[model samples]
Target: MFDMFKNNPISSIACVLPPALVNAFAKQNFYSPEQVRHVFTNELKTEHNIEYALAMFCSQLDFDALQLAVTYKELRANVAKECFGGWPRFNFDSLLDYSRQSAGAGGGFAGDGGCGDGACGGGGE
Candidate 1:
């Protein structure tokens, strides 16, 4: 994915930003890189903190071939709850709710519910 943005510096940095940060900018209708940077800086409160939310956000790349990453660990808990037998002894009720809301807001369902194509069908099992 970085290779795809090698020629486009803005896109390269854009790809590096977490989806949450990207959503924050979009939600505020931020139109400039400086504005986005400002919000990120202030919300996080740091001069050059590598621990910015986006930095933590991009740590989990879903697929090696894709730039999209799933940084929401709650989503994983939800998956484990709904399909893999309810998260053992953990309290996933709220996690399930947030995951559902997030998935809904992001559009469509997840997991083996026969939503579409081969997706969420559990890998031909």
Candidate 2:
């Protein structure tokens, strides 16, 4: 989105994936356009402009909590190496907590750790 912090500041905020990147990313990852939209718009809810895509899907929307978290951790450690430089303390669990607290159970993720399988622990807890 930026080049050594010298690019257009406002435009740089946009996460624009080139056609080639979109095609390549699609081949490997499976997510809906809605999910991608939230990843970009989550800034209004959280201070950060962008979020761990998979984690946002899991924590802020209805998706597999455990599976998405595992994938987020892996991506945060592996594929998202560049992001680690700016984000020193990345924690999926904490992000989940924040998402839940901010949006309430209606936020949408499957549920927090307190809930049983297939149950939505959401804001009730």
Clashes of each: 0, 3
Inter-residue clash pairs, candidate 1: none
Model 1, 56: alpha-carbon shift in Å?
A: 11
Give the Å error, residue 36, model 1: 1.4
TM-score of 1: 0.20
What does candidate 2's lDDT look like per residue over 3-101, in tens digits?
Answer: 311232111121222122243334223345454445344432432323344443333233343343245554444312332222434443333343333
Cα shift from native, residue 27, model 1 (Å): 3.2
Q: What is the TM-score of each candidate against the true structure?
A: 0.20, 0.24
lDDT of 1 at 36: 40
Which is the leading candidate under TM-score? 2
lDDT value, residue 38 of candidate 1 = 58
